[model samples]
Target: MQPQSADGASRDPTKVRRNLTYDQCYYHPAPLTRVHGQDVRTRSVRRQARIARREAALPSSRTAVSTPASSGFLGSTSYLSVFRETPRLSKAPDRSLCDEFEQWRTKLEYAAARVVRLASAIPFYLEQIRWYYDKGRFTVIPAPIVLDSLSQTVAHMESHPWNVTGNWASIYSDLMAATKSPLEISPNTSARQFNSLFTGPHLRFEFIGFIFAMAGLSVQGRFPGRQSLELGNGEKMDTDAFTTEMVLACHHCIEVCKQNSHVNDLTIWMRYMHILLATEVLGEPSERVYSLFGDLTSDIYAMGLHHQPSDHVPFFLAETRKRMLAVSHRTDKNLSTAMGRPPRLPHRYCDEALPLDLPDESLFEEKDSLERFLQRLDDGGWNRDGKFYPATLMRMRHILSNLREQVLELSLGRSTHPNYTKDILATYKFSQTIFNRIPSRYMYTSSCWKEMDAIECLARMIVRLEHLFSVLQLQRIRCQENSEATSDLLDTCLEVLSIVVDLTGQYNIHEIKKQFAWIYLLKPRSEVIRTLSFLVSWVRNTVTEAQPSVMVGACLELNNVIFKLLDDALNYRPPLGSGQEDARLRSVDTGQSFEISIQGTRGDLPSDVFNIGLASGESLSWLDDLDFMQTSSGLSLM
Candidate 1:
């Protein structure tokens, strides 16, 4: 790994900077493009930076922050503490950027007419995404502002399509030689003001990527599944087609900005925005997902966003940077825990605080809008007016995500430092304190959701799951270290699994389970199953080590709860025939193996580590069918 300066990015000493060797360069240009011809085991490329400006306008008072609901689960944490301090491997960002397909390497240059055709849809795309769309904190630029920018770009492209792009290529060729300054925005920057920063007739490639990306999301939202989805242009395509089209467009536009070493909010934003989409469509252990995540983290570090921004940075840019980091960092921790891969954006390097829990609109709506909203905030900076903003969800999730990182260090780090475990336990204690402080409105309540709209109900469900999922991941590791733990694998495992079942039994998540839309929301379902299935093996192995009578009873009785839960998940579905659910449930009675994609391994476990495939047969017969388990004399099917 290339050593970084005090700031996240390091400058090259060579005659032509940005020409540093892939091994020696801490920061490279883009996530998707590689300087060297091949993928390597370690991460070496440096990325863009985020420079912020204001923090004073935000409310200084502390209050209870609100959160949203949803759950996630993890697989085994059975790997013992093998070292004093774990040599955490950073596999995610290390090779996350390489895509060596011979064909895709060629740059795509669309004709003027084709560019116009796509540009024309920007307004339509902006509207559809904004329509009842809940542009949560995840989406930084407001629909109206993006729409305004698109209108200008489209008009300019219509008359002189070749003119703008030609000028663009020549102008940016110079800036690519060395690192560039970060994009800046005042805290109170308005729609017009923001457009002035990036919008031009040249139609910046990053912004172009942003437009098409937004367009793709709108299409995805409407027809979320892989089956029978159609773009309004009258072509019927599956989810993968949409994803491929979006990804290609992202490549076409973003490749230039990246090549030129241009790291604006738009470039970084588009890269992170597309990570999950590409992962779902392409499938996980996905190189595409890595490319996007790598780009996101690379951009963050290059921007020096890991450090707290000075008051000199613009407030709007600073807050935007914070929000973006929160999203990327939260995701980094998530991928780390799920795969046991080291986190790319570790918390130790990230000193930037979570963005204030104010709506994006509050910063731009009126001259005094931010100040006014500040007064209405609860002590925790949450909006207490009974309205849920995307910031509220991100803020809550950030806290949980940070906790997830701490949990990882404790369970996986295996530190020999004095009172290391005690320090971890202390953090665990603080977790409860944090959860207790969350506002009541955002807390999960099974009885209360009946009155809310489907979307609102879903939002609240996500909040709960997010919190519970974090707790469950922590507990699974802690319990694994202590064999004396009860059958429940700590209460969180059961709770996370239960909520996942309820998603099918009680709500519409089954309806929206597509890789195309809400990948994070849909991800936990597979993760929850994976975690519980591993628990079966963990419990079975643990009980076998105990007294004979205890082992027999434990194997025969204790696992019933987990077995039942797993059984419920395998069989439950949201009554098929809508979108892709039909295919998932089709031929259930055929007694064939269910094929939900499973990836990688936890330690030296068998290649068939996860036998979660449901038999759909009566009487739990599939449990007997497991081949690898046959060797375990003490473990029994009955």
Candidate 2:
């Protein structure tokens, strides 16, 4: 065999194989190789410069303060070390320092708990505000009651502040007394003690309350024309009371949330806003909502301001949107991100769909005239709209009559991409669904409305299937280049078509058989011959693979369908002595055979007669006697 270059020029196949070209690029690269070797050094220098700039920009207090080993949550160990050159501070001397630190730590914990509780109530008030805004009615309950409850909740948080700092202090003291070595304060012990003090249950309740508050606020903003109220201080608010308050509150909370050291508080705040914003997007599109998007984008951008370009906010938003959309009741932030991306176009199965061009003025004229005729049928009797009614029918007929012409025009010869075949298969599948939904009774004898509906469905399905066939043809040609994968793709396309046959049901079997017959008869001109062979093989193989329970019925129905196509072929062209050589040959077993070939051996290949015609009476008895061949081969059957 001739060798080939990556671009497909003939060379030595061995050399081409050894080279293993990838993506049309040549490489004899070694491992650990850098693409921009000199740039790496420059980048490192610039990174250090930026770090220096950042450190220089820090406040004097932070710059001046460098903590000793003892400054960590664990007590200082330098004083206990045996090899230390400098004398460490004694425990007695540091006792006062430790006390002051403990007091400050307690205050921080109390502050955090207050923030969490306050944030949790945010969601609920938001909802109340939305209710008041959208309902155009305020709760009879006084504003004093709401304020009282909020104030009480805040006070409760202050009283019940988590004593995590105390717990950490106790754990450190215990570990210091228990441990023998300076480095023996195990992380596991610290984690266990921390978990004992602040469990996940507490985290969940706090986070949930925050979400409820945010949701409440968003929901409250929906009503238009709701009257605003003056608080006890007699301050008249002119703005949309709830939204304005919620937005401002959110802005303030966001700022405070920045100083939050605990990840949970920040995470919950982000989640609450996300839910609130999402709620707004669902009911209506607003300019205010667009500002929410801008804020969210800015926040994400700002968070990664000092990080690498890999921290792209849009990228995270895109991915998070995918995940958030799958879950119900996500935050306003999540919803905004979800709404950020453009909506995807509906899936297409075939390439031969209508062109991007708008339908010509003539089609519109025809549609208008058809509608007028339909109106007459609806208003006066069909007798009053005589010519118009018939004219509309003629137009319908014209549309249905052009199905084949349209499919032929749309066939995409051959494509090499996996998408080509996959798209074809998808199109085929979608068309099958629409075609199956078309009512069988309406096919041959229904009113104009019914016929038009069925024809439209049929036309669309046929167009899609045509595109699929084009893709399949292209795949077959490409198989010579990459047989293993392309062959599997072809098989998948065949499987899809088989499914189409099953969904066609009894009514559609006839129309499909006639269509299939037309295709096979057209041979190379249309993909009929290869398509028919694949279908027959699929039916035979599927029957062989069927379990004993359903095998009998599946085989009978499949054969019945096959026989109908055979019958169409028979009528189109008879047996050899039946006057036409084509007709006679069509009914004979000489046209095609199913055979298996063995590689690397000179032996006779096994053959199976794949005659598509009827056998002798005895052979036909089992099938016909089973009464499976009663349906006619027409669109009415579909």
Candidate 3:
């Protein structure tokens, strides 16, 4: 019998078998003579015989084979035999390969679960650490261990293809992307090319990773158990246990890269973030914080980031470098003012252009486009095209930097120049212009981002207050020589104090408590307290009235606000001492007399107020009760 072709034509059974054998030999290409003993029949016949034998040796259950096309001989056993023989043509799966794949899947699941668990606990850890910080029992733990554990887990997850699903999955993805390194290139590559490809990405990744981790920890702290709460497990985490874990984790993060000797921009940025968190949120001593700041400044100069970025550098990278310097400059200026230290990054060292007032997305799209846009707006002022919060901050920071210098000169009695007052007025006017030009969107009252509104408002308020303080300081210097300037100085000081009280009253105790967890509030809070205390002492000494009037009412309002705001764990007290009393009443003649006292009960006054300036060596200081001033290492501006 002959097999029928697809066209329904009959063919010779012998010829069909011969063609099938030849086709199998061409496709499979196995030595058929070795499998089957030598026979006098042709090669095709022998090959067909060998295939038939192999199929027959298999069990009945495995006889059927699947094919993509059909060339049938109806009810013919010979055709079925050829199809079954084709099944043996391909290689079989090895048991070892299956086991290896199973092992990999299992490890991948384990790694993913571990990473998720650790990342999930980050918030709880932050809360615990904050508790310790508030209690002044903060202890440093090794950060490398925790980072190493997380790193290994991430590596494990990277080895397999597994779906990561959750709210934090995006953050995890960002972290992974930020930390990813490029493939290693051959050593024979040119040094310049190698530097361009490897150096920037590696450093950018480290800085970005550090930022992501810190941000993750911050988010966890800010929104505790929100993720688990959404899971509907109804499982509540213990506050104490989680807080302890967070404290340990934070210590680890802050100290992880401390031992690295190769200081770079990434390391400098990491330290900058860490220092801000430690000093501001954790309330670490200013001396320790400033010491780290000193180290960071050294790194900045070493990398030449303090200078204007060259055209050879990528625009995005150059801008980033400039932003880093700007931040460093701001940090140094603010801390120097706060701690009464000479700024490490002086005006001479800071020749870099300010960061452009462009949105991150626009700059990210094409660096060259941004460069061209920036060149067009070369007046070195705020770009009014968009509402950029960071640019506004940098602008305010620049004004504050100038204010710091002005205040410094005035404090040190070095403001004897003829145009000193004129310069101060010009700077003040510039700050006011910038403040007015700020888009309403960035204002706390007008911003759509309510969550960040309070912080934004606080920053703006601080900058304004600093500007006012600078003017008041300058006027006080002028008043020393010309008593005619006394009334203007007093008015400016009152305005500064009034703004602090007004802003403090806007937020309830709960809102203020929440703001305390953030670093931005630290300096502003300290400044407010110090300024209020100064005003209180000034008013009591200078303003003498038979009855409590407008100035007296303002003084009382400020006292109430400060007492309420600082009543928490901070325990801030007004500076009260005979030295301060002497300084305030020193110019008064023997014929002059005035009564001075707080209007509240004994409980309203800080116990330290009575003790402050009581020592013979003590003298009246401006905002001297600030934490930095308490340190013996503080630089003497006076």
Who wins the lDDT comparison?
1
Error of 1 at 282 (Å): 2.1
lDDT of 2 by residue, 378-427 (tens): 22122232232212222222222222222222232234555665644454
Clash count for each candidate, listed in order shown: 35, 40, 5
Query: Could you tell which candidate, 1 or 2, scores higher by TM-score?
Result: 1
lDDT of 1 at 285: 45
Off by over 4 Å in 3: 1-213, 216-261, 367-378, 412-458, 501-505, 508-513, 516-638
The estimated TM-scores of all candidates read 0.61, 0.22, 0.45
lDDT for position 425 in model 1? 66
Q: Runs in model 1 with CA error above 4 Å?
A: 1-101, 107-124, 131-140, 155-189, 224-239, 415-420, 487-490, 501-505, 508-638
Residue 247 shift from truth in candidate 1, angstroms:
0.6
**Stronger candidate by lDDT (1 vs 2):** 1
By lDDT, the candidates rank as: 1, 3, 2
Q: Model 1: per-residue lDDT, tens digit, 1-638?
A: 22244566532221123454434432112233334444353223122110011111111111223111101122223221111122342112222222312223542222221233344445455555564245333454544556667666556545644322123333233223221334565545656776765655334556667766766666655654444543332233454344445655566555656666556678777776566555543434444555467778888888787885547555556767777788887788766655445678987778847677777666555647667878988777778786766777677777777677776676556567688757656765766677765678777654444556545556677777776665655554444444333333335544554454344333234433431243322333566567668879777775553554523543545466577757766765454456564544442223222333212111221111122322233434543433222212222211
Tell me the whole-model lDDT of each prediction, alpha carbons only.
0.51, 0.32, 0.43
- Candidate 3 lDDT score at position 328: 74
